[model samples]
Target chain A: MIDRLAVIGVGLIGGSLARALRAAGQVGEIIGCGRSQENLELALELGVIDRYAQDPAIAVRDADIVFLAVPMGAMRELLASIGPHLATNALVTDGGSVKNSIVADARVAFGCMPPWFVPGHPIAGTERSGVGASFPELFRQRRVILTPLPETDPKATARVRAMWQATGAEVSEMTVAHHDEVLAATSHLPHMLAFGLVDALTRMDCSDEIFRYAAGGFRDFTRIASSNPVMWRDICIANRDSLSAMLARFSTEMSDLAASIRDADGEHLLEVFARAKAARDGFVDGGKSLAEHN
Target chain B: MIDRLAVIGVGLIGGSLARALRAAGQVGEIIGCGRSQENLELALELGVIDRYAQDPAIAVRDADIVFLAVPMGAMRELLASIGPHLATNALVTDGGSVKNSIVADARVAFGCMPPWFVPGHPIAGTERSGVGASFPELFRQRRVILTPLPETDPKATARVRAMWQATGAEVSEMTVAHHDEVLAATSHLPHMLAFGLVDALTRMDCSDEIFRYAAGGFRDFTRIASSNPVMWRDICIANRDSLSAMLARFSTEMSDLAASIRDADGEHLLEVFARAKAARDGFVDGGKSLAEHN
Candidate 1:
């Protein structure tokens, strides 16, 4: 068990992690650090954190473990601020969605690959945010991917993995580049598409009528459009290369679909649509088994 | 009350309408007609219809009202066969998603504007199809848009409106072109995007991994992709012009978004995403009120 754990930028991810560790009785003291005093107060009152600190440096001074759960935009500055204060042997991990950039930023901040630094991302969250949205079971049965630097100490990685396991998360390891690429395709690109679709509809002359007549299908398809704009913006910029490639690929597919419609190519349209349906059906079945196994 | 109701293409839409009419005691007899004898028999056994017929011509022979609930591709042929059999005073209507084409097809099939022809579309359905998936309350509290031709008799329009009202659907009237345009932007475009996204992923070398790691957001966004491909393919072709226009517009927006990501234009991305979130929130709020009123 960790004697003291420090969580910077105490929002949904950090707050949830803190709460989970407390419930598991795996951490003796949890320190929450954030720019918003009100959020830290709420986290403390909710018992998600044992204490609150406005300074990241002070928060990690005596901590055995540190979790940087801030947005991608804030990761570099926050890492720099806490780098000097973290105990030499403290295990460092993060819950950022993008990993390559974060790992690079950590390297620059620490002046090298920090043996104690273990980059991780828990693939779990809802559209909600802030301390009020945190729950002890948020990471239960979720996938937490750890992408450690080559110079990282194996013991530090093991400690981070054990912490996630204590929170009921299944931990898996992958390269930082692969984590970024896979997430860009599965998560970032989807959010961008949703945001772009809704933004496009809003610009139309018949925008009101379009939204009024939109059925349940449209609503579900664009649900992620309601996600946090700032957070998503940071993700898009951080994973620009992979996401741009994905966007271009999707645009090509859409263009082909449009052409099929224009030519009334029923056979081609049917083939593409049938393939999509079968793929989605397979995904749903696989997801069910994953859930059952978890 | 109608003396007789002939429902052509007895699948989800037609079977649901017949069941609703019977539940409301609004029809004397319900005749189900379809190419699939097994589906028609299922409708007969479920009491969605009182009898079944293999020939559309014979089905509408003595019926006072005929509802063509077939796909867009089958509409022309079915209208041709039943045109000569429909009673002179029969109120002929349809449940096609795209109204402009159906109305145009009706004119060609009938040799002129038929005063009894009304084009209607119920903005409701699940992913499942066939008569077995039909239910009496399928259209209850749903919007049923009716686009009547200029030559349509006011009495015939009123009769069709009242029939839908008896099934607990809210009926609204609009120009055929307007209905097609609005639905193309709201429903057709979203479905095509989902299909295209799924199809694109299947083409990737990491297709299996992509699907395996897809989260709940991806599942919800692509749920409509699992719908019947033939039905969607017909929709894409039937509403080609409007859908193509929408596709071009959406592609432009996506390109702008991609540019923002490539340039790391966080402000532009945030502005677009924030606008989308606010719009989606408004739609959700409006939908809740609509549900409450219903």
Candidate 2:
């Protein structure tokens, strides 16, 4: 059991982790840390955390485990602030969507790859955020991917895996680069397309009529465009290389589709659309299994 | 109040219209016409129509009103087949997504815009199709747009509007060109983006991992990619001009976003994202009213 667990940035991910640990009797004390006093207080009142701290260093001073759940852009600053005060044996992991940058930042802050620093991401979340959105079951049956450095201690990695398992998550390990690339395609690129589509429609001369006549298909396709802007902006910049490559690839595909339409090439358009439908069908089948597990 | 109502190409839209008219007691007889024997049989068994016919011309022989609910690409063939057989006083309306194509096709087949020909589009549907998926409430509170030609009889247009109203739909009128332009932005462009995204990911080397790790956002954003390929292909070709214009505009926006990401212009990215979020929020708010009406 963790004697004390410190969670920096007590929002949806951190608060949910704290709640899950408490329910599983895996942590003796949970300390919430954040720049937002209101969020920390809300976490305390919700019983997701046992106490609160405004300073990251103070929060990690005596903690047996520390989880940094802040936005991707804030990871470097947060790691530097807590590096000096963290107990030498404390197991540290994160819930950031992007990992390469966090892993690199950890190297800079700690002077080397810290054995106890296990870079992790829980492949679970709603468009909603903040402390009030926290729930103990958020990670149940969800995939929590750990991208451990070569210098990481096996014991620390196993401990982090076990903690996530206690919350009913399936933990898997992969290289940091691989994790970033996979997420860039599946998550980040989709968000970019959604935001771009909505932004494009907003700038159209017939914007009002377009929105008024939009059917359920349009609504579902652009639903993700309503996600938190600042958080997504950070993600876009943090994973720029992978996301930029994906954008170019997607643009090429779109251009080909446009050409087919322009030329009235029904056969080519049907071929692309049929392939996409088949692929989407497979994805939906796979998603059902994932949904059942979660 | 209609003596007879014939619905050709009985599928989701046509079958639903027949069912809604029956529920409202707006027709003396309902004749379902389609090429698919199985679909017509299902519609007959479901009592969505009072009878079934394999020939469109024979089906509309003595009908007071005839609804052509076929894909945009099939509009020309269907119009040609039924034009010579249409009753001189029969009011003919269609549920085609693209109005300009249907209007032009009707004029070509009939030698002129028949005074009774009214092109209409119901801004409603689920991804699922076929007669089995039809329901009486499909068009309730939905918007049914009527695009009447200059030669259209005002009496016939009023009757068509009244029939849709009896089914609980809100009927509005717009020019054929305007309707196509609005739907090109609201519906066709979004579908193209969805199909393009899915097709792009399918061509990736890590396609399996991409689909496996995709979250709810990806699922929601690509749900429409699984829609009927032939129908969407037809739409892509029929509304090529407007949809192509929208596609270019969207590409420019996407390129601007990519440039922002490459330059690490976080402020610009945040501004674009914030605007999209606000627009989507307003859309969701407006959509709530539309949802309530439907």
Candidate 3:
């Protein structure tokens, strides 16, 4: 019945998943694993999991499911150490932002494509990270994109989809490569722009005064730039190719728009602004939650 | 004491100021004037003003204080109509976003700076507009930037500054040119970029699917893009030169950033990202209300 579950790297995503599973009564036992002893203690204290272990191998010893919630860069080392320890019937998944690299690692570590390895990315998070920000309803009304590899088993994919659906998330599937590309366009490139904008503003020496006067416009434009540097650093590295391509395309568009504005072409500027406004409305119309951000 | 105050264009900013003034017992009677009969009726219904007049000239006939809360484009026409009727000693102010253009309008309409005509920009707003969104605390803890022209009366400026302080806002003084430039860099250009980015995304054939998958970053980046189109359009035109300059600078930076990423220059990308992250932190450190967004 896939009752017992052990989530490695019990940070915000993993801990929150544990909490949701318990609240929904979807699993029998929840064991939390992380490199940080303090985080493990906090997860247990928060009642996100019933037990904990330090080693990834020890944590997944008898579990029916294991989630690699660690950073993408750390996934290879983790999968290598724990792959042989996982029961053949156990489902292995991850909450990593990038799926392709991790999918490759899993294949290499397990000596073949693991039928039960279903990679997923939950489109939900907050600027605050680690176990401190974990909550059961974090995924409520959120989208969870599943990018199962070609060799993934249909039954395993269904199980993973069902698990996320139980958390009140809508599940959809895409190929790993497509997921990386689409996300780079929609998510990663925006973060890069935000980070780049803020950096440019900071180096301008006018930041202190500029920030003081930052009203609604600046607040929203720069909000996502306040995310954890280490986490974002890893994301940028892991999804370099897609991010690079998206940034190039975005820069081209930005330059074109800039040229139109510089020429005082109000009609052109209005057309661009109108298009953006329509797109934003379409996003709201798509029934996505504006809550839960980073 | 400013017993009877006349609010021009009884919309969000004007109505909100009237409400706040009434709540603070700072005014004995609040009279609202607007071209729209329905707006006048709505303003009265919402208690945004104690009374309403169809003509601005009649509304300010006996008013001790007059606040122009119309769009920048409408400012000149409004001042030209109401200038001769303003009570001789009345203190006049405005809630316009762009100050440079308004200053010029005030100078031409009033003929040798009116004793009470003060240019002010309250750096506070919501995504919603109109009389319905007006609230008493809209200015609390918000910045109120005042741009006093070369010939502005010192007494008039002080009176205007005191009025803003009563609404619980911190006041700063700057030149009209500088005010427009600073705001263009911080507010206007950012909005334009948001609108442009969203527009670019929307114009793409894959907009529907892309929007459906938009997560935190895209949503935040595009939120300001969804702000009142009319108001933003006016802002872009009124502050075009400064906005153009800022846009050009930002585009250059974005281009450089894009090139850095495309070249797989991780070190350069990380540096840029780090600077942006720091500036955003500094903005938060400067106490911009990011939490209030959601």
lDDT of 1 by residue, A1-294 (tens): 999999998898999999999999999999999999999999989988889889998999899999998889999999999988888778789999999899879878988988899999998887778999999899887788999878989999999999999999888899988888889888888898889889999988889888888777888999999888989988999899989989999988998888999999999999999999999899999988887888
- List candidate 3 stretches off by more than 4 Å: A108-112, A288-294, B110-112, B288-294
lDDT: worst 10-residue window of model 1 chain A: A83-92
Candidate 2 residue-wise lDDT, A23-131, digit = tens: 9999899998999998888888889888988989899988999999998889988888888888877989999898888988998888898998999999888777899
Model 1 stretches astray by more than 4 angstroms? none
| TM-scores for chain B, listed for all candidates | 0.97, 0.97, 0.95
Please state the CAPRI-style docking class of candidate 2: high
Give the candidate number with the greatest TM-score: 2
Candidate 1 local lDDT, B1-294, one digit each (tens):
999999998888898999898899999999989999999888888888989889999999889999988889999888888887778778799899998788778878988878888889999887778999999898887889998877989899999999999999889999988999999888899899888999999889989988877777888989989988988988888899999999999999999998999999999999999999999989888888888898
TM-score of each: 0.95, 0.96, 0.92
lDDT of 3 at A258: 67
Query: Under the 3 Å rule for N, CA and C atoms, how many clashes does model 2 have?
Result: 0
Task: State the C-alpha lDDT per candidate.
Answer: 0.89, 0.90, 0.81
What C-alpha lDDT, on a 0 to 100 scale, does residue A181 get in candidate 3? Answer: 81
Better candidate number, 1 or 2, judged by DockQ: 2
